[model samples]
Target: MTSENLIKYTQLFINNEFVDSVNKKTFPTLNPASGQKIADVAEAEKEDVNKAVDAAKAAFSRNSEWRKLDASARGRLINKLADLLERDITQLAKLETLDNGKPVGDSEFDIQCSIDTLRYYAGYSDKIHGNTIPADGDCISLTRKEPVGVVGQIIPWNYPIMMLAWKWGPALAAGCTMVLKPAEQTPLTALAVAALAREAGFPKGVINVVPGFGPTAGVPLALHNDVNKIAFTGSTEVGKQIMAYSGQSNLKRVSLELGGKSPLVIFNDANLDEAVEIAHGAIFNNHGQNCCAGSRTFVQSGIYDAFVKKAVEKATNRKVGDPFGDGVQQGPQIDKASLDKILRLVESGKREGAKLETGGAQIGNNGYFVQPTVFSNVTDDMTIAKEEIFGPVQCILKFETLGEVIERANNTQYGLASGIITKDINTALVFAQSVQAGSVWVNCYDYITPQTPFGGYKMSGIGREMGAESLEGYLETKTISIKMPGKL
Candidate 1:
């Protein structure tokens, strides 16, 4: 189907129906590829958030149909949702590419990952049972895992569909109802997914999707008193705000997978070609609009010069243009604002005396496309080195020792992900163990799987997102004790 045909739903998805905003207001969503209007989606605000939350709260009630459903039934519904997503992968990927300006292939990859994530959590639905413990003094004790109830999940613009699955998977598995506020920039696919959820036989008020700006829709969802938990995946600044909003309102459980300026350490013993390719993809994938993009590349000085040369060649050869175009390795940086931020950091890198290896300019006049930028002889204190330059800019820094590089890698206040590209198992093991980040890749970078847990350390934010471990954030463990003499 064509892109126009895929623009089927632009309204807020609440209580299993698509409806206009309370005030009948709408906002235009732009296509970052051509700087043109895709469609005007329903702009959800405080009232919308309240409406969605009420629906979710009702769904979580003790006698609600959703809560009364069996765990295996929940799993069946989740699998059905995954099936729908997989069936409509092409349409959703095109929609995602049109809205978020990522390559269609990457969007397709995201949908597959989302399906995998959903299926993974679906299997966990029946498996998430309570454990009977050996209690003291003739008393039987056990722990029951119950849903947190009425969760508010705010996903980021980058990887919209993937983030939705990441949050919805576990929460649905645990039998929790939710109101999700998709990023205003890329809300169309989310609305589509919510439609599929209804088709998958989810009860009304079990899931809702509202599309609006952060202050209007996002803030209300996070601060809603009825929301038992708030899960956010975005900038560290906004993550802090979500935490504060939870505090100001109900002290709700907050799970944040925040920003990162992760480092990739390349030892001299590493394969030069492999290291170059991995590092290139690490920072440049998704046009570098990634939370765990390895922004800093700390190369051991022995092979640093050679790696820099090959890296410059790789960056120079990358094609940047329309995400829908063929042979395009890089796309525009989400929007004009993101493009401007990347340009600002690129300038900072130049002014700080780093060698501009290649590519540091805007590619076109219409879209928000940027050159695949590379810099060598970068220092730790440079703006490009320190900040999470979520763009196609690579900063290659030289280091002397493993000890020194490990310290340098952990120097940042943010530690979401880190990587080591060395053949030495000893070096890789030590680096993986010593890294402060949540997920440390040994030979690869940004190696995320549905089975593996992913999150950050320090200012990168709190809590995990994927795997069985993420189920904890969505559930509350309650201990039950009974006297043996009280048995019937």
Candidate 2:
């Protein structure tokens, strides 16, 4: 590897130290751009997971430094980590791009978002408060919010560093110690950040990162009896498995941000150019690996044909090449398996009678790349419309009216995000209210801010990830009662 893109910190980070796994096992993390092995990451199995959890549990104990630290002091430490991350943004972003195959610009944005997330939660550390209730004159009643002890967080590969911030920010802000499992495919960035957490003077075991496969390390962390909570961002299937493991084990508090087949609606009143641009970004960003990607594009009949033409042109012109290359908007899929799955789903779309308007084949001889594929004349029954393809593929379906489109959009097992492009405020409001997704964007798509709460409804996952609402998930409510003397 070049000096600018060298891999660093491949060992498991436990108790604020980089250490070898119990078995000393390692897995090759690939550079998806060249389909080459970038580095061998230390693999954490059940034994290593147990060690990390034990450390986290101890750190979270009342007598430990982490728990004994004042809430504002904890916030300061998290802010310090954010400052450290800001200083190393370039290096961390490069590592993310090298390992995850997203464009460098995208990686930089992710790092900035993560830093902002840390800062946001730092502000909340001191503000997390309890309430005093006026009860019967004879009694004093109050409720306090306390951290949920040790937490196990499993973050997905698509947005590795950002997802880490989503899970780590609140858990730490609430005074909880955690054992984090970065996705095996993209563990480099998470490992690098653990060093920063140590540098920021976080107590040993306050933040631990164990890199390994889901079954080996992830399941153990999720099922660990000492872990007070499990926060995960991944596929719906795995989210379900984690929930089941929670039930089978300690019934830990579980929070999930799962999969989505989000819809982007284009009403006739929308600016054709703007709608086309937004829709292209909604699905094609991150190679469509986003859990809340707007994969389903619904267009009103008045602009149906026009929208398809412009969308096809945009997808065809999108550059699919090396993520590090200048002006390359689209990058390779995460790995060969993901690329193959995307291609298979594309074929199914064609078989199911959706018109393949443009690119649907893999690109280049090396690495895992797929052309930005688009399909027109898609019906609700098509596999591409129903399933979370999680690739750079967009399915465009025509609708006649608002009521019909709302029904069609809500008819899915996933309800993570939805968007509408319309100039009419009434139309946007109606669509936003009627849509079943957790987040609804008007005249925009995929506009995420750290201040806004993000999550989903129905099968899309159980709880919120960002904003004040997220802090509630990492905390527990305890009610206190004291009887007063009759002399009062």
Candidate 3:
């Protein structure tokens, strides 16, 4: 099916059925590439959240098909979903590109990674068993790891399908039902994935996708008393709000993967060519919408000038325009608000006395295409260095020694991820160990895989996603004890 056909599944997915909301309200989702409306998705509100929650709660009830099914059966179902996702890679990539305004190449990569994540969790499904405990008496003691029941998942727009997989993979593996809310800006691929999950023979209410605004759908889902947990990947501000909502509601478990202004440090001994390319990709990937993007580029004072010049050249050469265009490396920001914010930050960088090396302006008056911006001679106090621009803007700061760079890198409130480019193993190992971020890269940047645990420290997030640790967020541990007969 073409992306157009794929986008027709824009209705709210509830109880394995694509249906209109209770109020029949809808919102138009736009294509960031052309500033055009692709489709009017069914807008879910409080009532719709209640209905979806009811479905998920019922599916999570003991004796329900989803709960009573064998562990391996759940694994098989998830694997089948992965198979279908792989089969429709092309069309899914297209949907992602159209809705998200990311390069088609990046979309394809995300689809593949999403498949890998799902399959990874599928292998983990039957393996999630508790253990027997030894007691001081003849009594038998054991523990069972069980699903945390119904969950509410709120994912961001920067990565529509990939974030869906990140949220769904572990939740499904743990045998939990969920009501997910896709970002209002990018909901097409999410709705399409919901259809695939249904085709994978998941029981009704096993998964629900509600497309709507944050205040209406997202807030209600977070505050729902029946929701056993809320797994959210978005802004730290919004994550804090959800945490507050969880406390106000039922004190439900909450796992958040929030924002970051991650750093990428380069030592003097680092290969200049590799360092330049790695630094470029670190910040420019996904148009710099990544939470753990290496926004702060700290270079050793000896090579700072050379690195800045080459970094400017790299940013200037980066291709920006149509997402589907051949050789295009950059695309529009998600919407007007994002574009405006990036431009605003770029202006602040210039206003606050940081030298603009190259490409600080928007491409045209059409779609939200931003120029790949670079700033040199940036001090730690500069706006570009202090705040997360979250754009294709690299702020190059000079550092004298390892201790200084590590201290500067750890100064930010966000500790999602960081990187260091150096040839010396001691430097790399020491920097990695010293960084407060969740994931650290030595030679490369953004080296994320399905099997690795990904999350943040401090304000970045509350829990990990992907890997074995993610399963803990969706599971609850229960202990059972048996008394032996004294006569025996």
Model 1 lDDT tens row, 40-86: 99999999999999999999999999999999999999999999999
Off by over 4 Å in 2: 1-5
Give lDDT for model 1. Answer: 0.92
**Runs with alpha carbons beyond 4 Å of true place in candidate 3:** 1-3
Off by over 4 Å in 1: 486-488
Model 2, C-alpha of 87: deviation from truth (Å):
0.5
Each prediction's RMSD over C-alphas, in Å, is: 1.3, 1.0, 1.3
lDDT of 3 by residue, 258-283 (tens): 99999999999999989999999999
TM-score of each: 0.98, 0.99, 0.98
Model 3 per-residue lDDT at 18: 94
Tens-place lDDT per residue, model 2, 1-488, is 24244576999999989999998899999988888888888999999999999899889888999888899998999999999999999888888999999999999999999999999999999999899999877789999999999999999999999999999999999999999999989999999999999999999898999999999999999999999899999999999999999999999999999999999999999999999999999999999999999999999999999999999999999998888889989888999999999999999999999999998998987989999999999999999999999999999999999999999999999899999999999999999999999999998888888789899998999999898999999999999999987864
Q: CA lDDT, every prediction?
A: 0.92, 0.93, 0.93
